[model samples]
Target: MSLNRRCSRTACGRPAVSTLTYVYADQTAVLGPLATFAEPHAYDLCEVHSERLSAPRGWDVLRLAPDPNAIGPTTDDLLALADAVREAARPVPVTVSAPSAETGREVARKGHLRMLTSE
Candidate 1:
């Protein structure tokens, strides 16, 4: 039993390696890497199906391939993720600064909001 997501084509149960989406306004069919999540309008395709993909008359098919030598999820990516998590988890210090004359004073405090007096 394979855990891979299957191709969207009917009767083709092969694992999907790419994703296909149509740009109706541009008359273009884009084939790129497998999406992080399945979209309602996008179609997941296997290698064979992706290679055999075609567009209708006056439509262009754009195949976006990954860089051959580029390897992702490196140490920098992990470090950046960790840094972002730490920044998000860190407590935000609250400060009440004196309002300038032009800005006016805060009149009412509401849920995640504050009403200010007009000048």
Candidate 2:
């Protein structure tokens, strides 16, 4: 349940405080607050790494101010989470129709499991 992500730097076990992403085409590096999710191309950096980060010789670095209030979830975040929980808890209507032989594949799914029909 831990939401914190570890820094991408080797030997640095600190929690990530910022995210680093490079724009190859523009030869620019962007450093900002930790992302809500781990992006495949972005690097998660600790406070120290983020502060000490330097771009390549020809690259420019863009550092964004990390919002102090973003360290924790806000009221809107809590309310959104509550709304999502309520939505998930509500019963969903599932209309099962006889599968046509021509289209035997599963048409839809919900959550993690699949509803398979025997052909």
Cα RMSD for candidates in order? 4.7, 5.6
Clashes in candidate 1: how many? 0
Query: lDDT (0-100) at residue 66 of candidate 1?
Result: 58
| Model 1 poorest 10 in a row by lDDT | 93-102
Stretches > 4 Å off in candidate 2? 71-119
The CA lDDT of each predicted structure is 0.83, 0.83
lDDT (C-alpha) at residue 45 in model 2:
94
For 1-119, candidate 2 gives per-residue lDDT tens digits of: 23579999999999898899999999999998888899999999998999899999999999999676666788999999999999999986654544545535455456554466655
Model 1 over residues 17-107: C-alpha lDDT tens digits?
Answer: 8999999999999998887678999999999999999999999999999556645556897999999999999875544445545577766
Error in Å for residue 42 of model 1: 2.6
Query: Would you estimate the TM-scores of all the predictions?
Result: 0.61, 0.58
